[model samples]
Target: MEMVLEFLGNIPWWGWILAVIVLVFLYDILQKKHTILHNFPVVGHFRYLLESIGPELRQYIVANNREELPFNRIERSWIYASAKNENNYEGFGTDRDIYEPNYIFVKNAMMPFKVENKHPNQKDPYFLACAKIMGEGRRRRPYRPASVINVSAMSFGSLSARAVESLNKGCQLSHAYHNTGEGGLSPYHKKGGDVVFHFGTGYFGVRDDDGNFSMEKMKKLVAENPQVRAIEVKLSQGAKPGKGGVLPGSKITAEIAEIRHVPIGKDVLSPPSHSAFKGVDGLVEFVENIAEATGLPVGIKAAIGKLEDWQALVTIMAETGKGPDFISIDGGEGGTGAAPPSFADHVALPWIYGFSAVYQLFKKHNLTERVVFVGSGKLGFPAKAVMAFAMGVDCINVAREAMLSIGCIQAQICHTNHCPSGVATQSKWKQRGINIEDKSIRTSFYFKNFRKELLEMTHAAGYEHPAQFTMDDVDMATGDKNMINTLADVYHYHKVAVPFTGIKDIMNCPHLGGGYEPKKEKKDVKKAIKNEEVRY
Candidate 1:
């Protein structure tokens, strides 16, 4: 009470006026951005603020029912259904996008049906596809994700403790895997849910008192967390490939210090490349060592780089016989916490391109049969996932879009530590706005809907199962009807060795999505918008 009185005493009559003026200024700035402008200054910010909460406010505050969220409406309902142990959804009319360019809408969709209809609308995708991680002749394991959609790498420090707890608990409730991003694994990470503890270049999960990788400590962590499903060597993320992660020291609170096992108030850097491995061959060898040492699937995450590097990598794999269980492709346009504006906007290939390129590369090396590909980049929609698979990707991962489904307003607050959605902020007040139970239910609901939509579309794509649909099954219709991009037109025999012969060698990953023109394939997907000169 004294502290409150003291705080109140500190503010003068002008302080309130100054605060209001500042708020008015911000409101004006935001109003222009949200496209909900009003002439009123102070009052405009209120509308801008509420507009900023566009989808979230509608889903959580206004829509008496929880299932009526943006994008992940069904997902929210599914979680509520599972929690109450009741039916996930009620009979409903269509809840989908009706008008949008470049959409995959059913030309003649069926009229709305009741939840009790003979065909109980599947709450989730009925069929799950499996990806075979290639090892030696018989060493392949099918990587059929229990759920088509899984959590992406949102680090613990980057998010709040309650946020992490909610995500872990949510994963447990939904029976899906959550990634322990580059930040060191928190105790909250071991909340009895499957985890993909990505061992970043800084060796976060293995750091010690000196803040470096400790083999013994790593072994201990692996032994303790039975739920740790896999170990990913995150080489480069899609948003900022060839860049290091920077967590300023000031933000490192006591709890964060304990979780990361690093001293508070010290900047942490996870470099672009790992200290453990040098080149691609060394990369493969180290992944193998980690898998052998940890007894779990070991894979690398990267954005599509130079074609030559990829070609060289496949050759190394063929000769060394060290094949990864999976390869997670991060697209150039992917989102991240706080990257330099340049890197965030102009770094790697878009997921669509990365998906195609990596898919093709894996096929050419015949590693596609052995190594599964998990695609990530602005992907949350069923059409997006199916398209990636049609282009050769095994699975897909979503980040910002997933956050959106779970009530993130994209206020760009992940780095500022002011997320109104508890999912990203450490602030107690902002955190309260994010009801863990409600958000978690919303999370599962979103994933279920995504799966169901994919199944429906994939089934329409002429495949009984999502996995059965091949590239030949997809067809692209553009204004230039003369240039048809069919399933066959998109993929060539994924030959392991590119003919670097008389033809200038080109690095092609099927994930690059066969460009509008084959000649345009050389442009990196990341450079799609800021194109300067053409170079693959």
Candidate 2:
């Protein structure tokens, strides 16, 4: 050791540097994994470095404030400001193209009224309101959701344990509900907040050893987790509508395997359809049975595709007087942990058209008042939430934005288990970057500020609460539809009246007899809406 020290001390520092560079070059030249490295040796390292940091450079330097895909800089900045409790107000006028096609605007009241402040007795002053869901017969118990903007499903296997813990604690602070994604329940989900346990076709947490649905396991979960406020049966997600949930084998750790009841180092694929139900009638029956067994509110999460299929479900509900307690509609633009490009890109309806179709259909069946509606998919911004409300969605669920609040950089590498921000990966070393305490606080702050902004927009639209916002409060501006029309008009919600006159007179009444049509129903049932640039 002394001899080595003496030799090093005798050698020049540049000599040592040169020696290390030579070693690195030799190693690169010998390695075959990377073609660039093998071809260009040390010089190729620069290319790899540049490629690794390319996303950052494009995000911060090259891309304009509004040019980023998915979520732009302006949107991300708003979330960051809310998370940090920093001022997000802009100094100059709007940079957006307000007159651009598909541009949306709120119909501000001529004399905007002041909305009432939060109740003093409320646990969290940031909590603006709550929505109560009550079911009849077996599902008689009522569950009141405290927040309109709650966390959407992002599974445990997909997100780091630290991220789940932070989100749960944040939900507790903000009085928001945290959804246990279809991956199933974990101890981390019970940190300190309300939960909505989601069940995909896989039947994860409540599945038997045979990977079949287990009533006993479900009862056990409900019995043990009092924090679970509701259950959502996921028929389909907006992203990868028909595809199943995929958890790569490399991500399945011992803990995840146990939680999900799947073999370690084995790829986990959830079935595309539930085994408990075969069709719409079976679906309704399944929901009723689950609600009766759990004695809690049960809902269905589905991406709209077939308009007649939705109509059939509503029609069945009208006939049987039984249906899900709530319906959560996911748009095609919604995010996911992992999905195939074909399913993610081509399947399902966008939130606007989907919500409108379902909403009007429910109104036609006189079942709108009985069921709650939740809108999800790219609704991270206050304006988007308000627009959803105006379109008749009772509440909104946010997935990616919540991830962003806890320091996600939109690396778009979530599926690789190499998330740079530590929000999605399961590796312990990578997960350490997310400080649960700090990120939890940031999450709470973001939720509070978002709700605050939503209320502000609600008041601007002459509504005390977002729930009061109607189709009249929203307008869509585009080149094709130049004039501002109420959402009701755009979605075609024509009114129909039935007179109490004699049967002979009723038969003679043209509107009631056959002319009564709310936005002329399409007669081409055989022809499906073609998947094109503008999908319904």
Candidate 3:
């Protein structure tokens, strides 16, 4: 023992350090989990360390305010400020280029509607509500949404339980509805908020042992969860239109398995199309059946692709007077679930194009008022919401914006289940980062602020409610600096008058402007005559 002690004492500190380095090198080379570590040994660890914090580096130091994709720094900052109830006002006049093509300009009225209550502590005088009552005169229980802006469809499986709970609580606080994504309704969703239970081809939560949609199970689900105000059948999402989803066996925890009604540790496949229904006709019938059975408003959500199917559905509805109560248009740009790059990039129509096409079809059939139009592609912003409302959308749903309110940093690594902010991952360790009470309050603040801004814009546009907005109220730049066109001219469809109760009040209000009148441009006669006409 004496000899051993003397030998250890004689060993230099440098020698010991070298020995530790050698051991680490051996571990790195031997590890099979990381190919980089296995191939490059000790040096490879630096790459991983850099990659782990790359998103933060880019967000803070590398990317500019307006450069980031999905959500720019400016957009994120606004959301964060609103969530914290801080000053969201920008110092500068505008960061956006006014001359840019497709730039939306909200035509302010000559005499804007006077806002009554502008006090900070007081509630907003302009209380925004859905213009149309969902399933009014058609269903057993008609629901009038208190707020026009609601939480979009985001499955509990895709998001952590804490995140879902926070969103539900936030929705309750703001009196906004929560759309439970195709993953099925979890206990987290029943937190006193009104719910729009959504199901995809999987028919989760409402499926039987055979993995088929069971009306009995659905009825029971609705009965037990009284918070479920509406039901939405998701034909396809914007992320991957016509494609299905797969929950890997690795992600299928016991809780998830039970909620999804799938066996534990097994891959679950969601087919591209519903087994319960076939074509457009069948889909209408299915929606009608669910509405009939549940005594609640039933809707359909889809990313627009070909117009043939939409045309047929509208036609059938017009002919039979039986169809979905609401139709949610998911723009191709919408992304909550991870999807294949090909589908996410080039598959479905964008929000503006798709919504206009669908709305026009419904208007053509004189069925615009029959169905509530809900748009869900980045319509969270005040300007975007106004544009959507002008194009005939009754409600707007926001998904990623809601996620941002709950501390999502837009790491864009949601698919890996390594969400740093704990908003998207299922890992308990990651989810522990979310503070339910704090985040819930933030969510409520964010939603209320959004509605406040939207209402402010609505009054500025000489209207009491968003439903009073028409295609003529907004205009888009036509790429040429010399010209601009109304949204009706741009989309090639005239706005059909929808029955709105707010229009009468707006017309009667003395403070409100009569109608949108474009300012006539003073033209140069000499230049015009030199360029073309002698007749003038």
Write down the lDDT of every candidate, Cα atoms only: 0.62, 0.79, 0.84
The local lDDT score (0 to 100) that residue 62 gets in candidate 1 is 67
User: How many steric clashes does model 2 contain?
Assistant: 0
Report the Cα lDDT for residue 70, model 1.
29
Of the two candidates 1 and 2, the one with more favorable TM-score, higher being better, is 2
Model 2: how far residue 63 lies from native, Å: 0.6
Model 2 spans with C-alpha error above 4 angstroms:
1-48, 115-126, 131-138, 481-483, 494-536
Q: What is the lDDT of residue 462 in candidate 2?
A: 69
Error of 3 at 427 (Å): 1.9
lDDT of 3 by residue, 106-176 (tens): 99899988755553224434346677768888986666676788899998878999999999999888778
Q: What's the TM-score of every candidate structure? A: 0.70, 0.84, 0.87
Q: What ranking of all candidate models by lDDT puts the best one first?
A: 3, 2, 1
User: Which model is ahead, 2 or 3, in terms of lDDT?
Assistant: 3
Q: In candidate 2, which residue pairs get closer than 3 Å at backbone N, Cα or C atoms, i.e. clash?
A: none
Q: Give me candidate 1's TM-score against the actual structure.
A: 0.70
lDDT of 1 at 150: 74
**Candidate 1: tens digits of C-alpha lDDT, residues 207-228:** 7766666766765676665566
TM-score of 2: 0.84
